[model samples]
Target: MKLKTTYLGKVYSFSNLKELFAKANEEKSGDRLAGIAAETVQERIAAKEVLSTLTLEDIRNNPIIPPEEDEVSRMIENSINERIYSSIKNWSIAELREYILSDNTKSEDLKRISRGLTSEMIAAVAKIMSNIDLVYAANKIEVITTCNITIGQKGTLSSRLQPNHPTDDVEGILMSIKEGLSYGVGDAVIGINPVDDSVENVKRLLHATHDFIREWKIPTQNCVLAHVTTQMKAIRQGAPADLIFQSIAGTEKANRSFGITAELLFEANELVRKEGTGTGPHRLYFETGQGSELSAEAHYNVDQMTLEARNYGFARCYDPFIVNTVVGFIGPEYLYNNKQIIRAGLEDHFMGKMHLLPMGVDICYTNHAKADQNDIEDLSVLLTAAGVNFVIAAPMGDDCMLNYQTLSYHDVATLRQTLQKQTAPEFNRWLLEMDIITEDGILTNKAGDLTIFNR
Candidate 1:
């Protein structure tokens, strides 16, 4: 019936808090002991600390994490896009879409309104706007849909290496490679989703991944997929902000939960661009999903897919290099099941293409859903045919920290070659150099050893 208490690296054990306090009382340290216990209980109460059990051995095995630092720095806060977000945040979704439809709506109003909308409203605006006007807005914003930072031409599909880990563990990263799959060494950018926002850990992943790139000489870039605000701070602090990453939604409030406003997103994108983080107008990489609006409680009674489309409208305002819809990754609550997941993926891709955005689709399903790899493959085949701009290449279509199965490494390679598709421009060149793929796009024996970090 003994329990262990760990505070600031030291461990104390007792049958109950009273016994621990008695020991502290003997040393006149009861105040400190009581404070630590209260704080621990308060922090973990929602996760249910009452039934929790920890042995001294367990405490020894698990290291205590430090307190989370301020997520966004002062410099980052000062750098958010100067465009006033209040203009749109105050408006309802219906009012915003109506404003988009009215010719009298000022360009600034539309710009501001774009930030506050969700997918249904985004799709609503797109559906009502004339093709010419959509084109006009794209040009007005200087949006760039197609980019060749690494190696392929326009219409060339790319794949992102999504090797995520809880602590940015180096071995976990290399495991993806040892599976005869070069994660960060692949065709597109190597973007790792750092599980926490710790600045040092973020930098460690960035530096290590860059080292891997150097060791392999892979024609790809690296990104620690943190929030835009966090990435901005990392960039300012000298982390490799190779790609500015964000998960945008139609509403300003929803975006804010991820530590960003629309203007903030714009500023983050602009900051990375000015810092030379990415080239060829492909600085920003975004991930979107259906049901985000509802998840945010900002759906405002609109359908999830439509709101998802609206997010593209909002996202396109930044003119991102890559916009990916993480279909079904949100789970069964919003998308419901396999059919809804598949439908939403195609809808998001089509919506992005319609918005003149470079679209990528993550045809994924989670363990909590009534779906499987067959659903992902089905969506993958459809997205490929839909000419998706990029797709995620994780192991078994699943990421450990992400806790969801996405497209696998083999799926990406086989799909690209079988579809006779090309990779990002410079990446295609690297594949050619490695002789992993032939001039006509056939996989060679060299492709098998792509798993090697260094040739």
Candidate 2:
């Protein structure tokens, strides 16, 4: 077989050290030809060693991403609340201990034993206390939309106030857009509050959202736009939505807002198609508001509903209020609730259109699976089999899986290197089966590592 060899001793075959060394050792050495082969292996091996060292340094120096202010505050507050709750549950015992320790006549030995607070333990507690302060101080809570208020007289004797009209709070509107772009998503989900029982308020929100998209540089194609209840009615009554967002809020109204939005989208698609003057049918979108109190049942229902919509060929956007990674084990009831929903969504049949974007972490994949191992492994493999394309990002999750466009030779090499370092057998197996790698393990393409490969 003809192979490209470089002065860098790039071996064109084999997956890693184990395979490469095995192949080389199987052949005899010492002749000129053997020397060339050995040199090739040695150079590649040297490259591997260099790469491994760099990876170690990279891992060590990898900065812990500063959690978003609101996210961190919520996490800390929730943690502290859980601690307080637990303490309250044992208040009787704690009160008894306090009483015992407060005795003035207690011996020095008894006092020492009862009131012992180790420097290390005190330091740990101090760290946690400090974090709580830092989190709250750094976090800011801001409303996402503007409103119009009517000041009413508290008493008949009081002076009458003029009826106030709904107006846009441009700053607040911009904040949500900015925050969404900065922390939520590159492709954001915009929600306009249209439930104030005022048509003007609905229109203002609509126009504001539309203007936000243009001013904030939020790409039209990348956004999933939604409007609340009154806005839907306004649109139904012949309000212009060309510059406004597609409907979403009305879906939760007493009259079935989702159905209304869906109907309008379909009608809008037909109108444009018939006119042949407007953009085509695919421009329409559906945004669904999902609320769950970090419970397994609630999560399952969210996922189930998303999956159901997907099955019906509808692409639904979900905004989950509570998720597991955020709350962790502290809120077991809520934790189980939200996780169940996520699990069901992932396992859904038509999960492609079911957007499972949690604000907490980004999920990205580098390659398609050439083979499957376990349930999760098979699901990942199936995504590849179904031709799901991954958008490249730095890294996500506890295990930093490099997100790539698709399973390719270069991706294989990168994934292989990562798996090798992490000693993750599942990752290695998936890479092998994806055909992103050669049977022997060499990258099928001329690419090297992720940093270079992405560049």
Q: Provide the clash count, candidate 1.
A: 19
| lDDT of every model, 2 decimals | 0.59, 0.26
Per-residue lDDT of candidate 1, residues 1-455 (tens digit): 34455544555455443233222211111122223222343322311121133222232122121113121212222322334433343443234434544667554554453443333334433333333344333222211343336432444668887877656678887666544243213555778888777777777777787777667666666788876677787788877666788887755556666667766877887788777345556778888886675667654343454446657766666677788888877777666577767666665765676555677777888898888888888778767765676788777666888788988877887787667777776777767776777787777766546344455
Which structure among the candidates has the greatest TM-score?
1
**TM-score for each candidate, following the candidate numbering:** 0.67, 0.29
lDDT of 1: 0.59
Q: Looking at candidate 1, what is the lDDT of residue 188? A: 58
- Count of clashes, each model: 19, 17
lDDT of 2 by residue, 341-370 (tens): 223223222122112211111122213321
Q: State residue 326's C-alpha deviation in candidate 1, in Å.
A: 0.5
For model 2, what is the error of residue 364's alpha carbon versus the real structure, in angstroms, after optimal superposition? 18
